[model samples]
Target: MIVAPGACRRLKPPYPYGSISISFGETLFNIRTDNFILGLTFLAPLAILFLNILLVFKVRRILFERKMNSSKKQRKSHISLTLTTLAIMIQHLASGAKTVIGIVRPELVPYALIIRHRLIDLGMISVPWIFYISHPMFHEKTARVSSFT
Candidate 1:
């Protein structure tokens, strides 16, 4: 289905209470809600950010233990993946905080805008790195399994 510019693709049922949409320039940033689910949506990214941190830690440990054993190509890939994970996690956390603060305080909208713009940039750059990391990890895991078999 096609969605028009500035229109949300998902249709949410309206609550008995009124809700507002937060907009910056042409884009609708978020929909304000008194409902718990909406509040959870604002907080969900924070949880993902934490997960990313955990993955980074795990990846770092692997890299550290294998530093001497792994080839230059593998080590470089690990470094790039870890750094990208870290940067994305930071960007997600900051953006989530900005969104929560914006909704709760409404006065921090400007700060939220700055955070949103930064996230947009981070998303553009980090998505490719995520795939980069995943592709190698997938192949490595497959190779290990095949050797075991």
Candidate 2:
């Protein structure tokens, strides 16, 4: 028989787990659909992206410092360094794109619905990263203005 979504234990038929133990929606220890663990799994990529963003910030700081005191040739080198950091940041964002597709295309794979829910949960978990993504944009504008000064 096909089961409905979010069916309670009442409808669950017995399954063999040593003996007949029919586990259903949202159990203790939660071998079935542990949202917390699922959420952490989803945040794994965001955490990596956050680390990448941190590395980008570190690179940006170094470039900014060098731009302040370096010769023209040295300043040109900082541009290449900045470009590399930007490339890494773009790669991180591309990973996020994969996550977004998983969220958006839940119909393509029903099992992925849980993962998609977890990804949506990441919005709460990724609050810190929101600022991380913004910082570089703001820094780039500031760096440009300072260069002209």
Per-residue lDDT over 50-76 for candidate 2, one digit per residue giving the tens place of the 0 to 100 score = 876777677678778787687755555
Candidate 2 displacement at residue 92 in angstroms = 3.0
Q: Give the TM-score of candidate 2.
A: 0.37
Model 1 misplaced regions, further than 4 Å = 1-34, 126-149
Highest lDDT: give the candidate number: 1
| Cα lDDT tens digits for candidate 1, 5-51 | 44323323332334345322232344333456556757788788878
Clashes by residue pair, model 2: none
**Alpha-carbon RMSD of each model:** 12.0, 14.9
- Candidate 2 lowest-lDDT run of ten: 7-16
For all predicted structures, in order, the TM-scores are 0.55, 0.37
Q: Which stretches in model 2 have alpha-carbon errors above 4 Å? A: 1-41, 108-149
Output the number of the TM-score-best candidate. 1
lDDT computed for candidate 2: 0.52
